[model samples]
Target: MGNEHLIGYARVSTQGQNLEQQRERMLALGCTRIFEEKISGAKRDRPELLRLLDHLREGDVVAVIRLDRLARSTSDLLQIAELLRAKGAGLRSEAEPWADTTSPAGRLILTVFAGIADFERSLISERTSSGRSAAKARGVKFGPKPVLTPSQIAHASVLVNWSRTLN
Candidate 1:
């Protein structure tokens, strides 16, 4: 450390889950501040996570027990890493030694993994688009159903015209 702080973030998916273990681990790591939340990692709107990110200062490190505890997907992890980099902060996972962004080797490894993840996402997007095109060619309809039928629209139009005539 020095003047930089090691902040911890602990999360569990459900109300029944306990955060004490994670909290104790963070304490053992000598974290100065900790943010705890009981929410699914899949959700995008996490108030505690947002607050932790907002509170980050330059040269600070965000310590997590595991990388999965922080993000559910590779893209999500990379996004958080990018944000940390932009703010001159770093991320460290105690369970995953290679995930320490403060070191040069760790940064290199993360970048390589990010490139692979991007390529995989592109392939999946292409396959999905091809499947959607095939379905459309076979007369599969998309989007919501019409709110009013043709008959209903015609009747409403007649009523409007009659009202205008009387006016």
Candidate 2:
């Protein structure tokens, strides 16, 4: 980690949210550059995150204020780790001491976190599926409601036919 400049990443879930605190923390930690993004961690296509990944040097370290700010799930975290490892870079979180890739303990801690995140996501998915299934069984309609009723559609067709005949 010596001589490797720390690159900071700050993210917020929405436009209304503030990133000042996260940015200030990362800057205080001696981050040379920061990529601030206003997007959900659950979202896969973050442009700033992508730029940060692309801008990484072989010896650079990506620093985030919190682990959750960098990734939403364990699998996502692991994927990010793999990407950094491939690029000869590393990741660190200020809030989660165990998330520092510069040390063996941090690596182990991140691994454990990934497993937990995966499990939690799976549980949520299962519950959501069950709820949707129950709703379907209850004859609950899904998707957008019709903008025009059947009679309105029939009237529209009649008007169209009359206009076409005249033309």
Candidate 3:
């Protein structure tokens, strides 16, 4: 698109890591603006990433050095891609050309990836449910520890009854 912007996002996992290389690469790739942050890809709350997402506009392309720099997992990548698609923006990875969302073939690949991620999630949910059911059958107790023991509860009941009798 004529009015589209090539916005860049560069991130590192820690304060000690340098963002200069990613910044320079993105700039060389013709990025109009770049958002840089030092945060782990595994972290859910990344301020600069959030800001970049919020900064996206229709026809904008988020250029990143690599897919791993953008997300830690496939599901996370899909979620971010979905957000970009919803916002009418695109995603491009310099390292992984197949990851570009602006092309038809790339979109198809992403669609297949999304389906696989969905199936994986479903399998995980089913396994968890089965495991929980089996654990319950085996008398495994789940959830928080009770605040009061049976004896404490009985004592409180007796005290309440005594107060009621007094009334």
Best candidate per TM-score, number? 3
Query: What TM-score would each prediction reach against the true structure?
Result: 0.81, 0.66, 0.92
Highest lDDT: which candidate? 3
- Candidate 2 yields a Cα-based lDDT of 0.90
lDDT of 2 by residue, 29-114 (tens): 99999999999887889999999999999989999988899888778789899899899998988888778988899878877877
Q: Give the CA lDDT, 0 to 100, for residue 66 in model 1.
A: 93
Per-residue C-alpha lDDT of model 3 across residues 1-167, encoded as one tens digit per residue: 24558999999999999999999999888899999999898899999999999999999999999999999899999999999999999999999999989999899999999999999999999999999999999999999999999999999999999999998
Worst 10 residues of 3 by lDDT: 1-10
In order of lDDT, best first, we have 3, 1, 2
Over all chains combined, what TM-score does candidate 1 have? 0.81
- After superposing candidate 1, which stretches have Cα over 4 Å from the reference? 1-4, 146-167
Q: What is the C-alpha lDDT of each candidate?
A: 0.93, 0.90, 0.94
Candidate with the larger TM-score of 2 and 3: 3
Q: Give candidate 1's root-mean-square deviation (CA, Å).
A: 2.7
Query: Which tens-of-lDDT digit does each residue in 34-133 have in candidate 1?
Result: 9999999999998999999999999999999999889989989999999999999999999998999998989998999999999999999999999999
